[model samples]
Target chain A: MSALKRVQQWATFARVWHIYDASWQNPFKSAELLKKYLMGLHKPIYHPMNDCGDHVIVINSGDIALPGDEWKRRVYFHHTGYPGGATWTLAWELHSKDPTMVLRKAVYNSMDGNLQRRYTMERLHLFPDANVPTNLLKNVSNQIQQLKAKPKRLDHYSENQVKQFPKIFDYPKDYILK
Target chain B: MLLNMNMIVPLGILRNVLFQSKFPIRSMRIFPRLQLKEIREVQNEKELVIYGEIVPSERANILLKNTHPQACPLCASGLDVKHTDILIISQFVRSDGCMLPRRITGLCRTQQKRMSSLVTMAQKAGLMPNLNPANSKKDPKKRFQWKKFNKYFDESTIKS
Candidate 1:
């Protein structure tokens, strides 16, 4: 394909991904896993030199889940190196202190921590609440699609099978009905 | 002469208790399974007195912390739960500390694993302190009575 034709083709096929910040309900979802999926890192077309990454719009980060009593039990430690330099905060405490920050840190930590990481992460929009941001990307033509909810089954296999075997366990002639 | 009697009398009594005492002494100690619940509950306060021993507490804490779901070291979710909240963390064995499984907590296996890793990490991080009194604290040597040595060994005379 010609360069111009390929560019147009690429633009047409370019996708945006919308990731629900189900962290509050599903905190076990690793930021690392999410980053890989959102960054197009798993794709065959991934180019280290080019910004071939997709835009990822994350919503409801404030509600992100952490696996255990980690919200309370785990302590994050930091140090200033002075005599009283070290300080720590419990996971739940940090969430309460700044829920957005707790998520931001997770997302940031998931990145490569290089110069390109800053630019790549810039393409990611993390919202503390479920509401989408209007300024950065807005509800544009390139907006990501909402997730398809899983289908539920109303009638079960057992009920359907009942027609074929009306009385699956037939009582013997000598057996009492009671 | 009186002072000599005071020393000699107790020494004689001690010797009798040690050497003259019959082998096995026909003594019966009712260990009765030595269960804590069977023992009368002491009115004393239940405190986790951590004095000097650091290794076992560190190990237990790491094990407990890693096993806890809410405080898992492997995932981000546990960055918010409590160390003792078994709802977010658990162990194979039921104890005063570990949380029960998710059928009780209503959490899935994913969350459970995350919580457990966090708890284990915390234990490794020394966040969970050793809980046993013997391991947690030791009496100041000066305050420990020499009489307590009787608990560990039988008194015997040395023939020079």
Candidate 2:
């Protein structure tokens, strides 16, 4: 192979490490996106028989947000083969026990239930907070963008900025401000 | 004429009532209320004085001006305000984070309902923690059970 062709082949076949911020994001939605990368769906040479796949490091999994009342409404079911062993856990209850478990299960469940699923999950790394290990941090060369914009808090703005924002409606003349 | 000087009526409404009577509407005069003033009360040694001061609203000079006689101020401005926009939502809120009454806000019935809903969403999202209830948690990040996490609202979910 020519020098340029050899470098191109090495680049396409090499594993790429991607970092994703899970703070304030919906876990189910993030899982779909992460599953594609974990299964090497983005690679041009992706095939069912190919072993090539990318590694995804997700941080702030503890901060995943559920839509509306899903925290209490959604339930995870489990059974241990015995008739009385069946149990259901609320989303929040499960999250309270392990913050990273929710996101880990989300990405795991997003993929097909084939035998290779467990092997594919081995490449996924989840951290409850932003503190990723130095070894894992060094491998991330790409970042996946967050699905939603972080909402700004009113107290985060300077006093001047709030006062300078345009007024929409004025209070009545007789109104007293506390 | 049946005179009740204590009654403070608008000129247009007074004219409509007087048009059917012998009182000459042309002879009447109008003292318009101050558009921008703050009323304050002072207790003197022997008496009380209640007066208004010309106090302009902050940023009044550069506010988005609007004029649509048939529509409310918000509707006339044509602003598609969302729940995440705390700046516009704060205008319709009191110091205690309560929604101002319809009469005070001067918003149409539909807009009033929507604005109140937006206000609720903003509070739920913890965007305006400073104006929340005194007994409530001041830090949104420290809220109880399931609420401490950051959550957002979709404006479409509002019924209006």
Give chain A TM for each model in order: 0.62, 0.96
In candidate 1 chain B, where is summed lDDT lowest over 10 consecutive residues?
B147-156
Candidates' lDDT values, in order? 0.44, 0.82
lDDT of 2 at A115: 84
Assess candidate 1 and give its TM-score to the true structure.
0.38
lDDT of 1 by residue, A1-178 (tens): 9999999877645765545544324333346655765567866777677556666667766655444335555676889989999989876567666656665567677777677877777767777676775764453444333232211111222433422422101222222111
**On residues A75-138, what C-alpha lDDT tens digit does candidate 2 reach at each position?**
9999999979999998888898999998999998999999889999999999999999999999
Report how far residue A44 has shifted in candidate 1, in Å: 2.4
- The TM-score that candidate 2 achieves is 0.83
* Cα RMSDs, all models: 23.5, 9.9
